[model samples]
Target: MRLSRAFQPTLKEVPSEAQIASHRLMLRAGLIRQTAAGIYAWLPAGLRVLRNIARIVREEQDAIGAQEVLMPTIQSADLWRRSGRYDAYGPEMLRLKDRHERELLYGPTNEEMITDLFGGAVKSYRELPQVLYQIQWKFRDEVRPRFGVMRGREFFMKDAYTFDADYEGAVKSYRRMMLAYLRTFQRLGVRAVPMVADTGPIGGNLSHEFLILAPTGESGVFYDAALEEQDWLSEPVDIDDSASLAAFFDKVTHFYAATDEKHDEAAWAEVPEGRRREGRGIEVGHIFYFGTKYSESMGISVSGPDGAPLYPEMGSYGIGVSRLVGAIIEASHDEAGLIWPDAVAPYKAAILNLKPGDSATDAVCERLYAAGAEIFLYDDRAERAGVKFNDADLMGHPWQMIVGPRGAKDGTVELKRRATGERFELSVEDALAKVLGA
Candidate 1:
């Protein structure tokens, strides 16, 4: 996309309200704007990154046999009442009344609603092991929403629900989701550690919070250093095989990991000081195995092989699609600005026209843009070379190709890597080949 035509309202100075690196960079890059206290309007650039993260989540979910089905943002409060959670959910739930005086709410989570939906159509054990997922906006009116999207009241999330006939079946489904979450985060270039966590209002005995360690994060975590070295992507994961899944689960669970709510003092003391890691972490994903919590409360039952009515076991998995943008910045950014992972970067590379009016610089940028590469061309007429350089670094594209009259005259362009601050002089053709190949 050409900067000349793009609606990038980049700021000259950091906003005083942004307390975190991600918040400040997001504002400066024009990726998002605050619509209210904790609600935001995602601009074009931010939407691109959001969609990329969503795509990775969807692909990983699909890989583990989960099917996608969107649910409504506004749901009937009657469903929560049926699950006996209407009164228990507290003030965070955005409760309201429609014109007809019927109760309604912007769903903070979808356990009760999904249970009702599943119960209405799925009766027999034939559909016992089905998983449904959706990527949608969720609202939770935080009393003090801060850290930009990291703790926003209104945000995008991917939530998946799994239904199984019995305990054993449900456990297998939960393991599949765990593997999928690991893979999803790995592909997004974040090292997320799965730590045992409190189920909170979701109400499940078995739960895990996938956390990415960052100094500015909200949640305190304790973990084994070995967890930082495991390569989940290299291992073969067979979701359908219970034994294989069980083995994988055992291997991962062997590591000592827990969030503050579930932290075991004795267990943490057992580890050597060097091997023990204690830090703040961002909760990017969470999964729960809630057994019959939702199914029994909402009358979701399936017939067993013996012709007996039984409540289906249930599980829920979630990834904070919008919060991940902030988490990524927190974990990856430097002094200049945000350092985006290539998988979720809005543009793979940026073409900086150091001399916009020069024929040589324009020709080089035009060829690169016309070659069908996903690039952002800095062709703004009024911007100076220094301003363009600073903007390119701040925008955090993987590669910044600087085209100038001098470089073009010498049949070369300066290619800079945003993450490493490494620069290389290459012919225009070589630069295109290297970046496109990457």
Candidate 2:
């Protein structure tokens, strides 16, 4: 991907309307462009980042045995009506009549629709515990959509629904999702803490919101420092073992964690003064155990072992796939630009051709680009060294391979790590081995 040929329309000046660090940096980095009041067209760079994030999300969901499915963006209004929410959902839901005068809606959530689908297919206790998920665009007509993707009217989300025959099973499903969410954020290179939260319109007594800490966040959070040090990926929790899952759950919730709304002074006093940590955070994901909320409302049921109809206990888990892009930026960026974590970086490194026209420098860059073409974004444009440096830093690739005329003459190149601002002069092969990995 050569900068000269790429569709990266980076801006020189920040958009006046962008109110947050993520929004401003996203615009200047050419990641997204606003098309409507709360809608956006993800540019090439932005789309790449979104896709990378979604891929990681999908992988983590699959690891937890949740099968992926695609549900339509438009759902029948009657579905919500069946769940007793059509009229109560408020103006945030975009409702309209179709060509045939059939009431429909751009789905804000899929609880009712998924309940109907599940009931129509599975009719017995044997199919009791099932988890299905979809990664799709959702709309919520925010009255004042701002902060770029963070508060957009239209955004991508990963929503998963779970069905269990009994309350006990439903709790297990919820815990499994909790574990999965923790692992997912860890892999995405962000420390997201789970705090007990209100259910809002989703309607659940048991709910947890995952918040990513940032200086400019909407919610102030107080949590135990130990929550930030877990190696969740290495924890051997057998999803099938009830005792194992319960132990894992207890371990996670053992530490006192809360947002301002739910903070308790008595509980705070129990945490060691030194171990208590306070910060602001952005909500990234949420999990809910709303047993029978949708199933009972939609009249979805399956035959029990005793041949009696039983409404399945249910739960909803959601991760704001698109909003996470902005939330991550909010948590991870520096003054220069977005410091993309290696897992979600559009390109692992950018090859800066300091002297593109010079045969020596050009040769070195060309060789390096050829060695790892797929993961490299070649800055082949005839731009000044300072321009290349700034752009590379703005893009925030993990590594920047600088090919200078002098370094080229000596068969050496300077590799700079964006996050640490550390530079190393190594031979062509050595640089390749370091950046591209051995």
Model 2 lDDT per residue over 94-160, tens place: 9989899999999999998888989889999998799999999999999999999999999999999
Q: Write the per-residue lDDT of candidate 1 for residues 1-438, one digit (tens) a residue.
A: 888888888898999999999999999999999999999999989999999999999999999989898889999988999989899889999999999999999999999888888888988898789999999999999999998999999999999999998889999999999999999998998999999999876565589999999998889999999888887657797788999999999888888999999999999998888999889999999999988888888887988788888888889999999999999999998888878898999988888888887888788888777874455555545588888878887888888988888988887989988998899999988998888887
lDDT of each: 0.89, 0.91
**Candidate 2: count of backbone clashes, pairs at least 3 residues apart or interchain:** 0
Model 2 lDDT-worst window of ten: 197-206
What's the count of clashing pairs in each model shown? 0, 0
Q: Which portions of model 2 miss their true places by more than 4 Å?
A: 200-205
Q: Candidate 2, TM-score vs. the true structure?
A: 0.96
Model 1 residue 110 CA deviation in Å: 0.4
TM-score of 1: 0.97
